[model samples]
Target: MDIVGDSGATGYGVVDPHNGWVAKMRLAMPNTRINNYAHDGAMVSDFLPGGRWPDTTDAVRRIGVDQPSLVFIELGGNEYYIDRDPAQYKANLETLTQNIWQVSPRSTIVYETIWPFDPRQSTSMHSWDEYGAAMQQLAVEYSAGWIDLRQFFPPHYADDTYTHLLNTDQIHPTDAGNVVEYTAVLNIINRC
Candidate 1:
């Protein structure tokens, strides 16, 4: 298995002690080796055509060489934060998945829906609801598996108190939250 995304998949060194979702997934499937190529602050454009970000594009190329059995992608939150056009976001996502297929045709592509951001920490011109819907449609069009984290984390935080699902920053998940993400990925991999 391979993981590609922004801080959510990378843990941004803040929750690294708990290990990211890829590490947890490796522990769950001890026989499997998971490669994580998630870069903090990466957006959908980073993986698109003419994108200058080498880390993401390099990872995609490495996938061709590594040829893992599965690849999980969790990105686009930054695109929303940067106020990218929804139509362009959709196109970039399509291009990304197509690039994945071109590199590792045998690998099963699993597209993770962007998690709902904590409104208190970040503001977005494009709503999480819009991103979620786009992800679902893209997953279907690309014939990839979909892991909707919204099923585990609510779209909005509670007004009364904090939750273990998200960290103090509310943008990233706490250690326990990573466990939730791990479990979700495990379920999807099993089904696949």
Candidate 2:
């Protein structure tokens, strides 16, 4: 399996086995090899042609070459932080899906929704719901799998006292939160 996107997919376990979702996934599938192309604070543009850090060794290129049986993508949150237009984000996502298919047509591509951000800390104007809807639609359009993180970690802006799943930063998830996400992915894989 190969994962590409931002911090949520790459952060915890890429180096430290105790913290990342990828590490936990390895535990779930001990015999499986996992390659992670996720980067911290990466946006949709980062994966596009001629963008910042564009190279043949980028995630898309790796996907093309590795052709992993399964690929998981968790991006778009940074797009909201940068106030990127939703239409542009959708187009980038579509292009990404097409690229993945062109490279590995048989690989299962699972697009994970961006988890909700802390409303108080964010200055961006985009809506998470709208982004999620666009992603869901993309999943259908490309005949890919969709993993809605919101189902397990609902955003609670009104009551800060509520037992939120997010970390103190309110942008990233706690260790347990990562487990929730990994479990969801496992469930989706099992169904398939």
Candidate 3:
């Protein structure tokens, strides 16, 4: 399975001054083959134009286009920071989804909704409820699977949702957070 995201997925299994929990899951799934390609501070728009991030085509090129059985995308959070235009975001997402399907027709694509964050701390508050609904709509439109990580994380993780899970900024997920995410991925795949 391919796990793509920002610092959350990238920081997994990495050791820094602040100990992360990705190592925890390694013990759970000793034989798990997780290919995490999330970069630090990445957004969906970055994959579009005018952003200094690698395009989806380029990123997927490195992942082998023979048709991955599963391709999970964790994005949208960073894009909310730049453009609040939902229309543009939706168009870009549609294009990206089409591209992925064209490259890997047999692949089951999973689109993750933006996780919840504390509105008090975050300068950009993209509505997870709305974004999630939109993502679900897109999933139905494209016949893909939609995973709602934002719904599972709330109450405890709300005050500073993303930060509470991150050792540094309010963007990355903590080890426990990663486990929650990983389980979600597993559940989705199992259902498929």
Q: Among these predicted structures, which one has the highest TM-score?
A: 1
Tens digit of lDDT per residue, candidate 3, span 97-177? 776666666778888874565433356545545555666778899888888887656644546543454435444566666
In candidate 2 the C-alpha lDDT for residue 18 amounts to 64
User: Candidate 1 vs candidate 2: which has greater TM-score?
Assistant: 1
lDDT of each: 0.78, 0.78, 0.61
lDDT of 2 at 5: 82
Once model 3 is optimally superposed onto the true structure by TM-score, how far is the C-alpha of residue 19 displaced, in angstroms? Answer: 9.1
- Cα lDDT of model 2 by residue, 1-192, tens digit: 888788888754233446577778888788887888887878767777766765423778788888899989898888876778788889888888888878888888899996777544366667878788889999998788999998777675646653345677777777767778878888998897
Which stretches of model 3 miss by more than 4 angstroms? 12-33, 48-51, 54-57, 64-66, 119-126, 155-168
Which scores higher on TM-score, 2 or 3?
2
Report the C-alpha lDDT of model 1 over 1-192, residue by residue, as the tens digit: 787898888865345655667677777788887788888888877766566578777888888888999988898778777768778888888888888889999999888975677553255456777877888899888777999998788744554243767776667877777888888888887786
Candidates in order, TM-scores: namely 0.89, 0.88, 0.74
Instruction: Output the worst ten-in-a-row residue range by lDDT, candidate 3.
Output: 17-26
Q: List the residue pairs that clash in candidate 3.
A: 21-175, 165-174
